[model samples]
Target: MNTRILIILALIIAGIAGWFFQQQGKISPPVNIEASEVDYEATDIKAVQTNEQGETEYELNAESLTHNPVTNQDEMSGITMNWEPSDEQRYRIEAGSAAINQQTGELHLSGGFTLVSEDKVSENKTAATDIEPIQVTGQTLKGNTKSRQVYSNEPVKVVQGMNRFEASSMKANLETGEYEFGKVAVTFTPVERQNKALF
Candidate 1:
């Protein structure tokens, strides 16, 4: 299936998370990480990732984060993430809990996962327009930072403008922009036609 937008959405999450993993060491002073021991702990964490042009690409906020040295995993609670690939669009994601593996570059999100995509207009020399935002909801999301692959076995729903799609499961390759869905259902609303009184 064609899922360019979703691919971009997942990639935004993966790319930013990967960057955060690489920089986690800088977030705090060096701590002796022993097997089965806590590496570090932090609260009220807020981080931002910027591109080469010095433009903010992603922002993350969380209530608490803990890292385990033995497992090489970072677990977080009350997570909120914002991703902006360009001036035209922004995506916001929220979850109650998440876990990222520093060694494997795997991220697992659970506890009420929601992703919202919105259209953004630049303030400088740009035309303003209104468009209904898109939203994706699922129980869990798993992404590989190195491979740029995203998959979920639980039920997933996606809303784009006036259209809706639901599936028993979903998988996507961000690198190739490929999407696969299982037991999919789709609903498309002809807003323009309704406005023209063609229905």
Candidate 2:
């Protein structure tokens, strides 16, 4: 997880639904939020939430959803979250399973996670060589909607352009677009120069 690559991921994942929770505020449990009825569990769910400016901010889709009263959390499996914090940037995240604290809006995802897509323009966008799409994977992660940050203590692997990186841990500050990685290993591939015709 190089600093540059890490920043790319952080910016994409940060600001992801932060305003969603801020607007919803604390979700108080009703009747302790036990999944006592069939309605508490649903399949193929899609949710769209707008921001204060009446602009669409995020969309969440899940294969199945359930409320866990014992933990007071909303549990979702096979989830895909898409966030568009601004018109210029968009990110798509996929998780095997996730739990959102009903009261605090804290989110924890586990059982493997991937950043499916990100459309943030980087400085290398205008480089002679095109910037390739990157892929990121982690076993578990935690995110705070309040701080707009994501953290992972598990191993993180990223493939950016022609570079590959791995780290023992990762922390991304979306606000500042900074990434901190622990004990990182990285490899870069050099591309051969292409000849162009000058008329």
Give the TM-score comparing model 2 with the true structure, all chains together: 0.64
Q: Tens digit of lDDT per residue, candidate 1, span 1-199? A: 5699889999999999999889884746567864657879999999776766988877889999999877788899999978675566576879889887856768788997986765567777465566566577899989865565668899999776767899999886644444688999886565464345556
Kindly report which residue stretches of model 1 are placed more than 4 angstroms away from their true locations once superposed. 1-36, 51-55, 85-89, 102-105, 122-125, 128-131, 145-149, 172-180, 186-199
Please give, for residues 66-129, the per-residue lDDT of candidate 2 as tens digits. Answer: 9877677779999998866554456577899988774675889898998643656646575333
Best model per TM-score: 2
Best by lDDT: 1
Pairs of residues clashing in candidate 2? none
**In candidate 2, what residue range of length 10 has the lowest lDDT sum?**
30-39
lDDT of 2 at 78: 95
Clashes of each: 0, 0
How high is the lDDT of residue 104 in model 1?
A: 78
